[model samples]
Target chain A: MAIRDDFEVVASQVRTVVQRFALGLLVIAAFGAMLVGKADTVLVEHARVLALDVVSPVLEAIARPVAYANRAIADLREFASLREENARLREENARLLAWQTAARRLENENEGLRSLARFREGPEASFITARLVGDSVSAYMRGALLNVGRRVGVAPGQAVVTGEGLAGRIAEVGENSSRVLFVTDVNSRLPVLVERTRERAILAGDNSPRLRLTLLPSIAGVQTGDRIITSGHGGSFPVGIPVGEVVETSDGSVRVRPFTDFSRLEFVRVVDYGVTGLVGTGAAAPAPATPPGGTAVRSR
Target chain B: MRVDGTLAILDRWGRAALPGTVLLFFVLLTLAPLRAPYLSDTLPLLPVLVVFQFSLAAPERLPGPLLLAMGILLDLLLGGPGAPVGVSALGFVLVRAAVMSNRRYLVGVPFLFQWAGFCILCWGFVALVWAFTTLWTWALIDPVPAILQYVVVVVIYPLIAPLLARVRARDPLNVPELSRGSARPGETTP
Candidate 1:
């Protein structure tokens, strides 16, 4: 019995010492990993991609039942608000009909003018729709993992949009999954312009619900209701895609509200607009697509 | 007789592995895309809480290396290029080390005391993550989301604490029974 007690005491002492030692070593390793992540992004990105691929199946399986449940709840809510929604849609549809007629007339006139001036047609955008599989709800980041990747021609730097408008751009692409860096992430910076005034500015995210416009000319007038669109200056995203609307301009700071409700994002379209200029994720952009006209056109 | 011995060894190993399996389940749960208003913005730190509870309850079962792996998994699963990797790992180790030091006070105490200890520790954990993230990105992240997450995690700790306790209770090592006689004044064997 005494021998057993001594052995137990020695084991306990060893465990205490080892725990203390491990704590220190782990702390050091954690810090070292942070440094390594910064210094070698490719290695970290590859690892993250592998991790995403492994978890994609599990998250996808869970997403189905959760999505159906959410849809069922939404249907219940819709049933309760059916009358109000019907009245609103009727009023909006009538107003849109008048605008549609005017827009058709303008389109005819614009097409004639373009022919007279021999205007080159811009590249047509093609898209692949993907389902949302994962969400990064961390306080410091705003990103989403999608269920499609390179196999579906979904590459980094492609513009991801919902039914409403621009949501974000693909940051990393794995074999079976990809991550989208939302326009509201602190690291996201896009060249955009005011549709009404044609004043170019950089849209910056501060990891907040609302994004801010930076690098706007000091003398340019920006109103709260002005529509913001991608300027196509950086070639990261296709030009003229609706981004957001200016919501606030207070004390020289301008805040824009994105049209897409990120919290409610279920599905998004990853668009390839044939602009191969922005080579994000250290991967070369795919060759631009050839236009049928035989004219030199970019393709991806 | 040999088969009985083998089965006994397997049972012991399975009992030891229960906490880890539960922790991994919570990690996957946290990563799932359940987008409901506040939940879409800030997920409850379920995995973090598990690490804390196990470290307090039985550190030997969830050692520093496993905690480190959990943190790295969180970082990878977060899938945000904006946030650097290892931030979660760092938080996990920091929390584990801190909780291990206070295990005596936290364990074998009234549940309220343990809850209170977690309430205080969570603040420090969230703040450390915020500070480290800011230094890494070199930007001032709005503290609102972090504060919201902290509030959510702290509020839900009590509801989840019992489940974590039950997991510890299943250990074949009979941890509480072994330590019951050695329990000091005002401490109850859990």
Candidate 2:
């Protein structure tokens, strides 16, 4: 009887110890979570960035095969569609050939006019072509990773473009990889000008496919179908890079239809411009003329 | 006899080896490249495996600290902005606690019911976190997929449960508990 009583007491004691330990752990977890919520430190960002860098290569290696497999599957699915669109494509091809001939004639005429006026041409910009390796289109972040990085001379803040037009700029750089933050990311803010009116506005993304032209006053001369281009006011992006066309919504808010189809993004061109150094020496030296009086020129 | 010895060695190693193997599998899964055509939004199969293992094993033998460490490691390894591993581990513990606390009522229940409960608990935890964090709202916008995945997990549990149970049967810590109850079958102790 005494032994049984002693066993019961010991069992109770053990239970109490376990309960106390569990409670202590819960308290610690709660406190730690609270601490994390309160502080937005550079240390956390650095840790996250480092962790991403370490994992990025592995992800890239994996993403390539997945992307290839997906392409194969998509190709198989599109075979029927391709056949249906063949006739349309042939007609389009003929039209494009005629348009190309007309464009060549116009370009020759323009060159003749420039030669007669003795106008000096700007230094030619170079480009490094790259393939899109991976993309993440999460609600909070929309970005893509490219195969080219610092070794390929692709640096952060360098603009990326496709045949269509401006995509976005490189936000993060790695040795073998670089992340491009699309113009549709919530954090992306680009200086843009209305191609028709030369009205400057800041194009900002609110985590949507469409980007908003903010800071355009109510009296700002903006209209639907107005082409948008890099204003070069920030000096980060080159001037006159095609951004998008303006579309006015029913609510009267203006948005941009980006030139590059982000959904079908595959190949991109990273402009091989040298890094802008301190006091803009490397950047400013290349562009000496500002079309006189710094007034925006309307393209005829 | 050699087979017996090999089995014995496996049995001894099973305690740490099993969980380690599961963790490695998850790491490999995370590293596995996902192609575009494959389902990317589905929850990983690892968490379900962990929960099922915990349910089949003797709770006292599996150290809580080890489980917590596993959770922390998973959180660090899996790239999420929030504490998915921590929350997942906590969910496992809570589910285990509930099962153990009500073992008498649950032990005789159909394995399907037990699995359904386990999946429901997991889904609830994930949904709670999603709703609270407000992240991945679009992915979970159609809750049907989430629910369907939960059901699929539950369905897969029965297949995995028996194998896990056999593994637990060989566990040294579990042996004592099993032996205690079966040594004198038919002799009721009051």
Candidate 3:
């Protein structure tokens, strides 16, 4: 019994000591991570890339059921509204047919005007469709994973969109997968213009659902619900892609309600507008699809 | 030192399995964002919750360093936000330290205070995240969203509490009797 008590005491003391050491080590580790993060070491980044490469397939497998469920839900909703949807589509088609006639007239007139001015040709815009397989949805960060990658001509700075509108841009591309940096991501900034007044502003991400517009002239004609579109100023995105509608927050600060419904995202189109020397992870730099004379593509 | 052979084996695997499952559970949870009806773009930190649970009930199983490592790994797993690398790591460490310092009060306390303690400790964690993000961006992120996220997480704790309790109830690793045997602490075997 005495020996037993001694052993227990020894064990307890040793355990306490070890616990303290572990705590100290944890504190050190916390500091170490901060240092490493700030350092942005190439080796550490490559390791993270390798780790993601391994995990993405597993994430994709998990996403399959989710995708199925989403599709099933959408189909159910569509079936429920079949009659109403058909009526709405018929009306929309009729309206579009009339608008199409007007737009064709405008197109021919614009082409004649452009030809008379000896205008250069626009860069060809092509798209690669990709499925979202994973997402990092923390309060601080927002990005999604795409199944397509450098293998499919997906490159960093390539804009990603949905049927709704601009969703995000490809930030990092790997061999078989890539990450889309959402417009709401803190690092994202795109040049935009108010569709009405043509006022230019920088749409900045503050980790909020609505993006904040910076550098808008105080006297510029921006109003609630005004449509914002890309200006194609920086060669990042082709001009005229619908971004969002402007809104004034409760605090009187301006924000944009993005055209894309971020939560319901399933698939996105990766659009290459051919900006060469943009940020990319590709080892072999591919030439931009830009035509000579640096004529920027105009996207819909 | 050996008890029932099967129980020993279960206990042996349970040490790694329990914490690992908790870690993986949260990581998976984070992959989907909670949208509007709840706070948008906000996700409850699973590792923080798991670390909080272990620090209160079974500090020996998790260890502060393990929590820290898990935090760092989680941060690495979702790296686009520009959050400092060690924010989660440090947050978990702080949570562990907070729970450990008050483990005596927290462990045997009523469920209310235990949860309240978790809620209180979560503020510091959220604050650290907000402060770090502000530093990273060189701009102040509105504190309302971060505070809202904390409130949401606090609300979620009750729902998660039952799942954790279930995991603990079935835990073979840290049963009181198993904790007191000749195997002692620091031995991989419980």
Candidate 3 lDDT over residue span A218-244, tens digit each: 534677889988887757578889989
Query: For model 2, how big is the iRMS in angstroms?
Result: 7.4
lDDT of 1 by residue, B19-125 (tens): 78877777777767786776655563778788888777666677677878878888878846535678788888888778766667776679898889888888888
Docking class of 1: medium
Where does the lowest 10-residue lDDT sum fall in candidate 2 chain A? A278-287
Worst 10 residues of 2 chain B by lDDT: B76-85
Q: How many residue pairs clash in each candidate?
A: 5, 1, 0
Residue-level error in angstroms, candidate 1, position A88: 0.2
Candidate 2: misplaced stretches above 4 Å? A1-40, A105-139, A146-148, A162-166, A218-228, A240-248, A257-269, A276-300, B1-38, B42-190
Reference-based lDDT, residue A34, model 3: 81
Candidate 2 clashes: the total is 1
Clashing pairs in 3: none
lDDT of 1 by residue, A1-300 (tens): 999999999999999997558877898888888888877766887888898899889989988888898889889999999999999999999999999999999999999999999999878889999999878667877888899998988878788998888998887889999988888987677778799999878888887889999888863499888999887775646788899999999988999999999877899999988774444342222225422211111121
Q: Candidate 2 on A4-56: residue-level lDDT in tens? A: 99999999999999776773574356335334522432333344345445656
Candidate 3 per-residue lDDT over residues B73-111, each given as its tens digit: 677667763457778888888887777666555754589
